[model samples]
Target: MTSSAPAPVAWAILGFCAVALVLRLLWLSGQVRSSERLVTYGLLLGTASGLLRERAVQDGLADLGMLSVGLTRQLSTVVMVLTFAPLCLLAISWSERWPARQAGISGLVWASAYASGIAMLVVGTHARSLELYIDRAEGWQTPVYFAFFSGWCGATGVLMTYTSIKELRAGDLRPIHRLTYLTILVVGAWALEEALSIFVSSVCAATGTGGGFVEFRFRANENNYIYLLAGGAMVAASGVVSELARRLRIDPASRAVRQLTPMWEDLIAACPEIPRPANPDIRMSSRRRVHRMTVEIRDALLVLGRYAEPVPDDMGGHGGEAVQIVRALRRKQSGAMPGQYLRLQASAPGRDVLDEARALSKITKHWNDARKCPEAIPSLDGDRAG
Candidate 1:
């Protein structure tokens, strides 16, 4: 049978799946646990399976002698089945705190189920061609094969739906996390669609009737399967995008650390009482380093408080604070005697360490510029002599 031209919606769904596949791969490239990797791989495979359903992709594979329509269908089905194993593991992992041994056993069981499904597909179905399968060749094996496949898919769908719903019902989920679970629900729906399609097709084939409500419903579900898969993939991709965006926002902490380093060093050097971190290693993430440095700078400011001179109200911004800090550093370094302890404000009020770092970063910029133009910094001697 000649393959029909792909509909516009089919192309759109395929395109969406392809993009989601790329995004999931990129997300997997970052730091992830083994279970996270498994789930991500499953998502990638599911998206890929959706893409494989496109007539264009099948034709391309056929052109390369890699896949005929029949083989493409089989491969897509197998990959989708494979996708559920990892997903099943993910659902189990998410639903409860299982011991490693229990988790491993669960994974193995899912793997065995996936293998069983593939074995049935290979051994039970005589027809490898799509036309033969769809045309309802007279055979008990075909019905049995579909029955097993449908049952496996249905079980997987039920598990996924259960897990997703349970997680979504929790009160503490962030909006993005809630969205991710909702997408998993969509995936579960897709799985159920597949199960229904397979079961109905098998029943119709067995009954030798292809032109009624049963056939119409089967065709409708079959057509919707790829769209459902694509929708799930797109939502999952959005979750990945959200994660990446959050990381991108945090990544600037590294730059902030670098910017504040000179100011931090100057303060620490002048106030030798400031204790350094024990493990000042490169392995620390940017956010942690920024927090540590912010705390250290604040402590150093307090230690050098006695040498600090109050800046005029007119000079009260970050640049003014930068000037005050610079003068205090000079006074402390010059061995000036402690006077009335006046606390110097070096940064604006901030909500968190990252915000504090950003505030301090502005001071560091002004401090660096003042050092380059020494005349811009008010002298400690001028303050001491006053």
Candidate 2:
């Protein structure tokens, strides 16, 4: 008697499904309003369907238990059909350009395929199960059952893949475009598995025996399990990529374009003669770097302003004292500027960075000079003017 291969892969698949569930729960509990949350739900539902189907099918096979193979098959078929609804909803909700007309058409197609497939599977399986289980034991061959599963998965796969690719190409969620591409690729793998299963079952029936076709049967099953594992992990991974991109604040497209698009329009309205250049390449990275440097310098000045007393001049040279102050402040400032500016730059840092550093240094000098001259200390209004 030939037996099925070891189930180590199935167990591993279950482990990932469990991890995915835990991650979803953690994300939902967090305070951030994240689109990742929606993707997480779709992923959990997809993987849970696989897990339960496998468990139900295995239990039926092992013990001829309360759940028959026919019922398990029907349950799995229904679950696979329902899986697309959440995924479709996720794609539609996240999409900025999924227009009402496009969405309505897509919805009708998905609903029809799913409804017809489930309906046929239910009716056919019930007919075969009247006297006995409608699975292999009943010698029942309902092409409609397989056709429904095939059609539902095929339609969903095409719709989601097209929608995801279009959304990315249209530059929605530009920073997370790679994740979107990965999602479609992963879903394509699932479509391939479903197609393979349908093909294998049909070939087995035509051949009138499982001989010479057992390998395809095994491959088809393995692909299903692999598809679930890879697809679930990819969805969760895409969610993580999106969150990480947001945290890093990296815009994949032209950040300057995104920023100055509205600002420039307003500027043109205010000043008509301001000629807009044709193909201007405004690199925002330098501007961002300078803005960050300014923040660091301000923070350093605040730290240095807290010092009660200065080190004695004899203890170190004037330059050494300056370096000490810069060092003491660097910890708070997170090394925004050079500890020894003369060493770091042949000329000086960039104009913006140097200017901010100089401004901070001047403020510190004024505060120290004022502390030394108590007579010069002014009232609140004078202080405010200063």
Candidate 3:
């Protein structure tokens, strides 16, 4: 703002806006479609406009000529002017609890915002003429432009805070509480900062040394410090948003699920009766297939559990459940049905799919080898039905 120069905070705000844009794009990459996403798009555009304005002033575009300064002023007004649409979309989405009435209310807000934005754009051409500048808007221009800017940002901030709190209260798992609250607080803090800036500019206009209609300005260092802090807040929020999107994306290549493949293949080969999922999607997330395989494996083990011969009293718990299977198999009559008698005693594969699958593979190897031993066990028909 000093000598028509941009503050470092202006650059920081631009960075924050870029961070927000990246986060929104990442979130969208997961195929998330909603009004909130639309809001993100609007915010992205608004922030982009803010960035251009900052750069315009920073590069001393105005020093080139009066036409350049006018363009710079127009750019400043346009920055907030661009935010209304996305903020309104957010407001509409936030009011989902009362859809019938919410749409009407949101429409009104939207109309008012666009109307204000158009008016500001028309009059804002004279923004450079005002005595005092706030966020690059002059004294007379500041109030009109921020009236719209503050409304959009302020309303969205409140709604988002409420949404985050509601989600926190409803969620049962405690691990996510940190992310949820952090998102809410960071967003609220940044919104409050911008909203407060609007008010500060108004105060400066009324009470500063300008005597009601003279240009007022602040030191670049002081302004940059505040922008940097606000930008940091936004960057932190962007990180959280990025992580949340990543967590929510469908995992088409799950390492744990892939590990289960070797074990599952062996199980099905040994016991063809283990039902496979019908018409599985080749591109579906591996987690889904993992679920089906784990369930069938559990069922197959239960069937085998019935055929298990009594553990010899001499054996000491057979080195836990898995080793017991090997010992019992090695000692069973040639006719014993290992498929029916085998017990799945390890952790269910769904929770620790990779770990359990590897363990199962080891067990599978042992069972296959034991079946080949000289016991010459008879087939199911050769031995009496258990």
Candidate 4:
């Protein structure tokens, strides 16, 4: 007698593929950065593999339309292997910061599993004569096909599990940890399902005659679809929760906005010459005496005589204090002595002089350097002479 397993299995796989597609699309919609394109690639690979596997099993052939079904089975196996390799690398990379070595190890693990699976598929296809021997209960050789496929999935599942737990323990918050955990659980479930699938298929392959316990007609595809739907929902839900957590930690302000707001007010107070954007100065006064005094003080530094002690007074009062502190620091001395920089009680006026003093001190350093190293100074006369 025949069985009804194959039809429902086919439909279930198709339905799971549709839902996986939806979840992936939703994920891609939220991410816009070019650096995040890996996520898109992974989602595409996984979805394509599942769809291809479903097509191969249900259609009983591949798109290439080879008369032999063995080639299609091998192709499906390859797709499954290729789909998870990048994901495993991503998981390892995410776990450790800037971990090229860890990612390489993850790749190696994936490669080993992929190789083993392909090798078994080759062996099973070529040695079709084993089916009869296996039916006669020919020991461990009977279960070699099942064992190979199960081992391949189990290895990946273990790596994903380790990575998830490692990251979670290391305080990776919100979306990253949650995403990893969901991936781990999905991989574990897939591994289990693969084992079950192999067991059932192996039984069918081994027992050439019908009526052995585990029949090929036993359908698990519907149940597998339900599992995938649940897994995908969990993963997407975790991502949403992570996004919320990120928002809580860091607000929505752009980096420039965050940097400028605190410092702008202070700068405006320190440098009154910096005209307010709203009010360009409309009036000009015959205050040449005031401007003349300002220019004289600025030019005074340019003419400080040689072989004189770099006068501390020329460096503004705060400048003098900064020089003293630097000397003390250089000597490895630590104790508060004279004037120290402090943000003070009065916001508008108390620290205004200090800002001015600091500016003059900086200019004073330029003059001091020139006095000590005249050769370092560029001369207009020298360029003309050249």
Error of 1 at 60 (Å): 4.9
lDDT of 2 at 17: 66
lDDT of 2 by residue, 7-105 (tens): 676656667766766755764436344345555655665665566456534475648666655465455556666665655555555465655555475
> Any runs in candidate 4 off by more than 4 Å, and if so which?
1-41, 55-64, 102-114, 126-142, 169-218, 221-386
lDDT tens digits, residue span 113-187, model 1? 677667756744466643564325445666676666676687778888888888888656667679877877887
> What is residue 53's positional error in candidate 3, in angstroms?
2.9
* Lowest lDDT block of 10, candidate 4: 301-310
lDDT of 4 by residue, 132-225 (tens): 3222333344367556655555655666667666666777355754775776766766665666665655555556434344333234432353
Whichever of 1 and 3 has more TM-score, that candidate is 1
lDDT of 3 at 273: 68
For all candidates in order, the CA lDDT equals: 0.69, 0.49, 0.52, 0.43
| lDDT score, candidate 2 | 0.49
The per-residue C-alpha lDDT of model 4 at residue 111 equals 75
Candidate 1 residues lying further than 4 Å off, grouped into runs, are: 1-27, 57-68, 95-99, 106-110, 134-139, 186-190, 193-201, 209-211, 235-276, 287-386
* Greater-lDDT candidate between 1 and 2: 1
Ranking by lDDT: 1, 3, 2, 4
Q: Which one wins on TM-score?
A: 1
Output the lDDT of residue 313, model 2. Answer: 39
User: TM-scores of all models?
Assistant: 0.60, 0.48, 0.57, 0.44
